[model samples]
Target chain A: MKQEIQVKCSKGNLALIRDFVNRWLDEQEVKGVLANQIVLAIDEACSNCMIHHHNCDGRSKIEVGLNYEGETIYVEIKDSGKAFPIDQYKPQAINDIIRKRNKGGMGIYLINQIMDEIEIEQQNDHFIYKFAKHLG
Target chain B: MEIKQEKQNSYISLAPIGDLDANSSLEMDECIQDWLEKGESNFHIDGQELKYISSAGIGVFISHLDEIRARGGKIIFSHLSASVFDVFKLLGLTEIVTIVKEGAEIAPHF
Candidate 1:
């Protein structure tokens, strides 16, 4: 099954996005820790796209897609904002982040840890961040 | 998200209701900052009411860990639902931070 949601790149819309993901996952019978992890990963990805790349510009928009096929779950976020190259991003060491008292890098780290596969697809006018996780 | 604050001896306990995502985390960050500015560092976060958490919420805690420790204070969490606790475990925060297991009192850790 496949589902998608599009929202303005405003931070205020994050909760709505999360609710949509959670409810959709529920409809797919993905619950408990697994569902929570997927939700967290999606939240991190969308927030990074909106806040870091688009500067939470209410004028910008982002699309999130969730698909379940066989035993794998695939999620994607598409936007026309700056491409963060999350697939190429090397998350900073946790110790370094704590030492610097930074709040930014951990989200990417969590996204990497949670998602099984991550790819960046940059098109002529937009960018797509694709992530996959195996149910096994 | 509404964060319920209560003073518990030398530490202040904060319980955030509902999901703690990117936007709402800013409010939590500010709450901690306000207490820090007022010379309060020790914090006990009650997670019973926290239904969901994203990395942004986790970041709020990590961002303040150093400063709080430097001030000779500690930030501890207790009463986390299983799923909420799993997020901390997933990030390996369970090793970096002190969390009072269920059925344990904050006094011992504090």
Candidate 2:
């Protein structure tokens, strides 16, 4: 099954994002570390949209979709903003990134580390981020 | 995020439990400012219960570093969970801020 939620890019939306992801994960009965990883990944993605993409303009919108299939959870976040340079944003190796303490660039890097798989693509003016993780 | 302040010796510790994102970052700023006005220089932030934090949150710490240093005070972090520690390490905050293993480690320095 799949669920979709649309949230506006505005302040005070992080809680809403967290609640939405947690509810979906609970309903799906995702347990243990897998659940925690998915929750954190979703939070990071939504935060990136709100902070980096929209720049807190409150004008852009983020569409989050969750899909449960067998033992895997798939999440996709689409943002209606300027295209994000996926290549430029490619995260450094975990050890290198962690050692440097690069503040602004750590979000995507952490998301990549936690999620099982991450694929980013740009279509027109929209940037799409797809993440997947397997449940135990 | 909810901030509960406790003063030990010359240090003021703010324990913020919950999400430390963009919205709550301002609240922390105000709390830090209030402590600064009271001439409280040293700070220890207990982030054990803080589940989430973002760049905006990190920015808050960076903005206050100068003030704390000018006053000859330091901000130390204690009891950060593995995930939260990853965020701090990734942002290179471990270099700029002093991260101790526990609140007790700060007592000796202050």
Candidate 3:
């Protein structure tokens, strides 16, 4: 199955993105903890794109694409905003994060923990963040 | 997100309803700040109506943990939906924070 959604780059749209992904996951019969993890990962990626790349500018847009093939599920987020190198980021240790009392840095960390594979593709005019998870 | 607040004994209870994402988390952060300004420290997060949470949502608690603890107070969570609890576990928060299981009393942790 394949599905896609386009959302405005605004913090207010984060809930909309989650709802869209959740509905698609539900239609695919993806339930339980695995489904929740996938939804969280997608939310983190899009949140990063909107906040860091587009600065939560409502004029910008991000496209979310989903595909389920065999035992793997693939997610792709495409946008024309500045690309953030999520794949190269080294997450801080949980203990260090607690010591620093940081609030905003954990989104990328959670995304890395939940997604099995992550890649960033820069095309001629846009960038795509690809995240995949294999069903056990 | 709507957070219902109540003072129960020595702790302040905040029950956040609906999804707590980046947008709504700001409200929860501000609410906590307000209580802290009033010298209130101990917190009990009733997650019964909290259906969903993201890293930003959890960040609210993480950011305040040190200050709350410095004031000799604690924050305890209870009645989290399975999915919400999974998010906590996935982030390794269950190790550092107190998560009271459903049907479990919060007094011990609080």
Ranking by lDDT: 3, 1, 2
User: What lDDT score goes with residue B38 in model 1?
Assistant: 87
Instruction: Grade the docking of candidate 2.
Output: acceptable
Which residue pairs does candidate 3 place in steric collision?
none
Q: Tell me how many residue pairs clash in candidate 1.
A: 0
Weakest lDDT window of 10 consecutive positions for candidate 3 chain A: A92-101
Worst 10 residues of 2 chain B by lDDT: B54-63
For model 1, report the TM-score of its A chain. 0.94
Q: What is the lDDT of residue A113 in candidate 1?
A: 85
For the predicted complex of model 2, DockQ is: 0.24
Q: For residues A1-136, could you state the per-residue lDDT of candidate 2 as single tens digits? A: 7988888888677778778888888888875445655776777778777877788777778989999897888898988866555434675543343344333455666576677777887788787888888765
lDDT of each: 0.89, 0.75, 0.90
After TM-score superposition, what is the CA distance of residue B49 in candidate 1 from its true location, in Å?
0.3
Candidate 3 displacement at residue A127 in angstroms = 0.3
Taking the candidates in order, what DockQ does each have? Answer: 0.80, 0.24, 0.83
Candidates in order, TM-scores: namely 0.96, 0.75, 0.97
Candidate 1 falls in which docking quality class?
Answer: high
Q: Tens digits of per-residue lDDT for model 3 on A1-48?
A: 899999999999988888888998898889888898999999989988
Query: Between which residue pairs do clashes occur in model 1?
Result: none
Per-residue CA lDDT of candidate 2, range B1-110, in tens?
A: 78989999879888888878767888888888888898888998888788777655665666677667777988888888776676677555676677888546677766
Over 4 Å off in model 3, which ranges? none
Docking quality level of the chain pair in candidate 3: high
